[model samples]
Target: MKTHDLTSLLEAMFHQSKEMILFVDRHGEIVYMNAEAEKTLDLSDYDRNQFINICGHCMGMAASGDPDCTTCFLMSKEKLTFQVYMRTRYGKRVTYIANFQQIDPENNISVFTLNPLSELMKQQEFEHQKLLTQRIIQAQENERKRISRDLHDGVTQELLNVLLEMRLFKYTKDREELDEKIEDSEEMLSHLLDYIRNISVELRPASLDDLGVEAALKTHFKWLQKQYGILVDFNTNLNKKRYRPEIETVIYRIIQEAAFNAVKYSGSDEIMVNLKEAGSYNGIEIHFEIEDEGAGFLMGAEPKGSGLGLFGMHERISSVDGELNIDSEPGRGTKVEGYIPVGERIV
Candidate 1:
């Protein structure tokens, strides 16, 4: 085939593509764009002189004022291909897998081909669901571990001592001596049984069903104080005492996760938790905040967690139709904040 024929075929394919495509000059000015690019970007009366900066719009890319944008994936000329989100002229935000290549040798002009991020968006949502499921399973496993430990170390050991006493009573030759040992053994066993029952209830309290979020949090925080000895400055101002069961469960779980993370990760000595109506609205909102003078990290970078603690926290918060915000800086401090809307419930 002739070179002209090949070029025509390539142009035809480019025009027919569903993804947006554009070519930029040495100064990042738009020089050429395909049909799809015009349609997807909703660009008309193309301004060839306008510079293309991925951070200039609704894209997740850092804005001009952003400290990290200087070293961002969008501005890095070294990368030949990468993925990023961009805002279109139509004002709709989208993620795009973009390719940049230096095609012009003399002027250093480049070509950029972009594909829509629909697939990635779907994948991210699916992963979010999977993350939530994993979190629930992990929480269940952790509860089982605590329960098992309590049974083994507390009740089970006490019962074993009682059993030994019972055996001694059975072997005793004197009736009076046998009676005293038997009574003591019976009392010990009874106390052990009660201890095991209490442990079981703590793992999954029946009161959670009979009571509500406030009660459940009160009990959990009491345990938190006992276990960690950290003072939790907790306050709840509510118009109602109870909420939908699902909402209550979500708030309870988020608080539990936040409190646990604070104790485990935050080196600070105090934490504040608040629950009340958020804003000028009828909806009840619960806020769980863990503020500590501990080590913090940059957002969007990988979080330091033993397993899925951070992931699980995010998942649980999402499940409740809530938002989780983490603010931290190295040696400065860390804060985990969760907001749950009661009227707009999520499970």
Candidate 2:
């Protein structure tokens, strides 16, 4: 094609392009901008000569607290293509993948093109959520393995030992010896029963399924007191009110994890838990709070444990359309609060 026709075609493409395009001269003046650029930058009303510095349109450069002008790629000699955050006309921050090229090396003229990163950012967020889901599944598997190992090694092995001893009773000749073996067997059987019950409760409390969440939690608190010597002040108004199995399970697990965290790390002798109904007649919700006046760590700092407990709690609560909030500050205390809708008001 002829040079004139080729130039015309190129100009038409540039003018019609959706991507923001700018031509800047050596003096940092925006000599030309396409229709998209004018709309994106909110520069349609401004005189072209007056909009001189590119930095004026960038959030990173214009930020009052942490101006990032020193890292601007335009100052570098090499042709650059990278992501940047810019401020639009309405003061909204927008992400863009920008391409900068020296159009005329002798004249020190450059062309800057920006592709909006909104869609790309959304894709990245989706990938991140997928990774988080995978990690949560892996954590659950690990927990199941640990519980399985405990049951096999501790409970199952002891039961096997009792069975072997019972088999030896058949060969006993002395009545007295047989009586003594019977007594020993009874003692071992009792201990084995307790171990089995403990394991069963750990897997899932029968009280939770048979009785309700309140009873299950009370029993768990009593056990926690015996095991960890930490006192739990549990307050609830449910009065054995039953919910859907999934909701009860999610609430139980969250509170269980929260209480365990307090016992393990809070360093305080007592923790408080509250469960009650909230909202007016139109909308009712169940809210729970676990608070400990103990040694709380920084909110955003690295966790002391595997970090899966809180994450798992969040996942479980979210599954029930509930919201969870954890607040903590070093040397103060920690509080975990959550709530879920229980449908319309019963009263």
Candidate 3:
């Protein structure tokens, strides 16, 4: 393209682009700003008599991951690109990615451009939530299949056996034989009831809602020992304390998942679990920890199983507006600990 045509195209883009563009002289004066910059920046506070300075809009320059502008970017013309917090039109400080470079050495002028960080963050959050939803759906499907298989293989088959025994009992020739058949059928029915109850408890233990998280966890730890060879060194100071149903559920499920993950992948025969209420200056916080010394995996490595466990652990904790931290390393132990800001329950 001819130089004249190219200049027009560039000028058109400079005005029409969504990003904010500004031209600054070495004196820190704002020579020009795009329409977006005028719309987004809080330039009203600055004096119009004296030229508006870029410092008026910039709260700080974020460099090397630090938000503090220890060294001013305006002083250096290093073809820099970094995060900056700029004052917005509404008197709020918003983060933006800034690209600045000296374009006119003779005039000591530079071009400064800004792209809002909020837009990029919003897009990232949307993608994260989309992935989380997909994983949750898949987890639910797997759980349903597990329950269905348990009913079919365990409860249903056993019930069928009892039904056949009853049908044969009526054809028994001797009184003693009939009595024995009836007893056998009763025993089978009793075992079938236990199997159904186990499945029900796994779905959502009634103890979790009725007795609270402490009781539910105690019961669960015992079951964990029986179901898996791994023993849980359980300790708690909850003392039958009650919490919001949602809080109780979140704590129980997180610890449960952490322990199960330990059992499946940690290669440890024993795990330690602690639930305590500690006094904090603000209020009281409920703290819990699950630790196991086993074949821990790298934090960002591909999970041996579905990565949904860790994702669900985070998702569950976040639902209660709590904090969580997981520490693990290869050949070292894993510790999953966090606190829920319940403080002391208000009387």
Candidate 4:
């Protein structure tokens, strides 16, 4: 193509672009605008060579006269670009990232360009929500730990001491009434101690840190069988010892969540938990699947509760650079699988 033809095509494309563009002279007068800008700001009344101040129409106020210019991020000449939400002539809110550049090397004739900031804002909002959810989970865990410690150290111990003192009194006094009361007190304390121990373990299983993953999981499965009567088929090919602490914690917690979900929602008599080494490799793969012949729902249907349980599980898996996959259908049990290439330093 000839140079003239290429020039004409470039100009036509620029003119027809959907992005709003405006060029202002050294004195801050509007000098040029693309087709979209005219429609965007209702610029039909604007005239050429007119002292067209776009302050009120484009950005809501004149550059030099607006009182907010002092704190407005756009006025920071040191920064070439910034983003803000501004009201347009159509009286609607729109986010825009503004870029300013000086056209003249020795003068202050700067050109300003704007691009919509909606996509960036959406991404930022998602990240903020993600962080907020994590903080909520941490706060909940802290509270649970507090309650567990109180029961284990204070309530349980105090009850035991009371029982001991009561037994000593039995030897000193020969009253039928007092003896019966002591027996009742002992029974109640026994039940309470058992309850407190369960609560403490649920809060944060000490076995998880003290014992390795294998031992902790064995205990967890026993608890599941005793409590829910759910037969969980567990298999381990872990020919290795211990894993990184954070990774272990993540795996344990996800298993807890997944298994709890299975018992609570899957309505299955039998489930499966498997942990094995990826053969001849340094990585490990963990799997927890719950299969049931129960009434299920659509996969896309909104989950019960705040729906953050699964989301939290996903985040935990991501922390270890792992992948989490959920498969569920109506009348079929849900299965959640997670794979983490073990030994990969997430940091």
Per-residue error (Å), model 4, residue 252 = 1.1
Estimate candidate 2's alpha-carbon lDDT, on a 0 to 1 scale. 0.84
**What's the true lDDT of residue 198 in model 4?**
81
Give the Cα RMSD of candidate 1: 7.0
3 versus 4: better TM-score goes to? 3
| lDDT, candidate 3, 1-347, per-residue tens | 54578788888988888999999999779998888878877557666743288877788877665567677778888556689998887778888988889999899999999988889889999999898788889889998999899989998899899999999986998999899999999999999989888999888899988888989998898889899877999999989888888889999999999999999999999999999999888878899999999999899898888788888889888988889999999999899999998855723
Residue-level lDDT of model 1, residues 132-222, one tens digit each, is 6887787789878987888789977997898788778757999999888888988887888778767766666666677777777777777
Which number leads on TM-score? 2
> lDDT scores for all predictions?
0.69, 0.84, 0.87, 0.68
CA lDDT, candidate 1, residue 227: 74
User: Which 10 consecutive positions of candidate 4 have the poorest summed lDDT?
Assistant: 59-68
Which residue pairs in candidate 3 have backbone atoms (N, alpha carbon, C) closer than 3 angstroms, thus clashing? 284-343
Candidate 4 lDDT by residue in tens digits, 1-347: 54578788867966897666666655556667677766666644444433265454444322443424444432434345565444565667666777666665465555666667776678999998988778688868977888978877878787877777677775756688677767777777777777778877866788777776777878888999999898888877753457777877887888878888778877778777777656325554554443444455577787864566787898899998888887878777677776776763222
User: Lowest summed lDDT over 10 consecutive residues: which window, candidate 2?
Assistant: 58-67
lDDT-better candidate, 1 vs 4: 1
Q: Estimated TM-score per prediction?
A: 0.61, 0.76, 0.75, 0.56
RMSD of 2: 5.3
Number of clashing pairs per prediction, in order: 0, 0, 1, 1
